[model samples]
Target: MSYKGPEPRRYPTAPWGAGDSATAVESGKLPAIRPIWDVHIRDTIVCLGGDGFYYMTGTTGDNCWAFNDGVELWRSRDLKTWGYLGLVWSIDRDGTWEKNWTARAGVPFRALWAPEIHFIGGNYYICHCISGVGIGVLRSTTQRPEGPYAHVLSDQPIKGGIDSTLFEDDDGKVYLSWGAGQRIREIKPDFSDFAGDWQDLAFDDSGIDPKAKKNGQPLRRVGFEGATFFKANGKYYAGACNKDEGRYSFWFASSDKLLGPYAGRHEGPPGGGGGNLFRDKAGRWWQTFFGNDDQMPFREKPGLIAVEFDAAGHVVASADQPFKPFA
Candidate 1:
């Protein structure tokens, strides 16, 4: 666990017996997400896996901030010291994903873009993506991870869907990766459908490379499209997000199972054009994407960077070590 870069004194403290609501970490710093919503924010983040920590949902503000990103900053059993569980679900007319499918699609889907909060089988789904439709799944019947959820797929229409992502795997199966820009699909386990056909895995236009040409042209296929898949050691990684060079980049590919012949994939600029990949369980790798808030100064601010991967995985971003959510 020693790639050592920004020690900041290895933040995270509370050990001794841990509790007082335990929370520590600020060494070389690197953990600051601030903004928990007050208005105007979109597609920020949506990580989920609770009971042990990690729940970052998005789309905050408007319609009385319906679920306002469901705001709940931090919590961790071991993702490092994070202890902030504030806002938990809202927008109700009777619940059921806000009174039956965003009020019968009459508008006000509020905060439902990439919500993803899965616990599966035993039940706890929450896969979202709605502003115009495409993917949805919100069942939590009860076992609460802060949910009043229960949308059971929300009717239909998922061809080139939104940014949804849900995976179960340990053998129970259940997969559902979305599509927005680069297209990907694999949902079927009664999650209501979609599981065969729709796998464009980016790098298209015939995956150009006219001799690595730059200004001379050739090398098009740019489209990472927010894909997601995970598993370590046993391998199966697939992380994406490439906006065709307009500035959102991150990429990854690997396989050993879960459909993919992906092996040793590559992209441009030491891997920014690649899409983000943040693996942790000790393998220690980080890669978050998105840049250009159009010269900051408050232009809606959108710039996140965290790079560091090497062990042959290439990307070694100047030894990045900022995201220390808790040592």
Candidate 2:
């Protein structure tokens, strides 16, 4: 396949307005909410449609009741404003499938995390966590933004058992990457089974206690699960949760090819980009991911932050905050 140059689209405007004239968290429009609490946003993408518009969705909290803790964060186009769209899977509180399995009499469905939706092969596929059931997919028949999506595949867990993300490479190949245990594998054309075999893409080698150890825990260093892949300037970039603690940071790697030999600086080991994205829109780069801790305390609302990135894709997080919308 011939390269198509940066995927033909750009992200929504940065939280603050554009250019060098605005201030961080511009005092006009209401702040964009994370929708799920506790669950720090791992990856984000602009969902595009054939009709010339885009939508938004990400794995946050459970659709039931968790801060930013939703199955999918629903956006109403205008990016700044959003609403809840329930769970992508059909397992409601009292559905046939729910009654037969997870909700049988009293059994409950547990954590659902890192749900990423993408449009592929003329259909939409939602890759998410169904607690103990492993990485799952929900397909939408029509090109509609909202879906009463149903599970198409649930064979096995993707290693870490959650934070599953689906990436379709430029070569018409699809791959699934997830956490709890970091893994990556090519998926069949149907987005069902593994295309070839599953492979480990990240990890924490030291086996030390991930929680108690300070900043040097190797066990916590590379255990990232929320994998998001994007191509730009002849490179494939995969960004994911850096570690389970210490400010919910993220790490990124670049490869000349889609899947292997990814090389870059590791976050915990030394120097590296700490958060997500290095750009926003209109050639303006905004580093973003998780801001604060958007939970019970409104002040602790872990919003999204966007900063500027240098030509080498390095973020200067310590620089003066930009006068952007989501400051």
Candidate number of the best lDDT: 2
Worst 10 residues of 1 by lDDT: 16-25
Clashing pairs in 1: 8-27, 8-28, 12-25, 249-275, 250-274, 250-275, 250-276, 251-274, 251-275
TM-score of 2: 0.61
Give the distance in Å from residue 307's predicted Cα in candidate 2 to where it truly belongs. Answer: 5.5
Q: Per-candidate TM vs. native?
A: 0.29, 0.61
* lDDT tens digits by residue: candidate 2, 181-299: 24567878875666687775543234334453567544422334555666666777666655333334455555676643454523321111122343333444443344422211122
Candidate 1 RMSD to the real structure? 19.0
lDDT, each prediction: 0.44, 0.46
Model 1 quality (TM-score): 0.29
* lDDT score for candidate 2 against the true structure: 0.46
Q: Which stretches of candidate 2 lie over 4 Å from their true place?
A: 1-46, 59-73, 83-88, 93-109, 155-160, 180-182, 202-222, 266-304, 307-311, 315-327
Clash total of candidate 1: 9
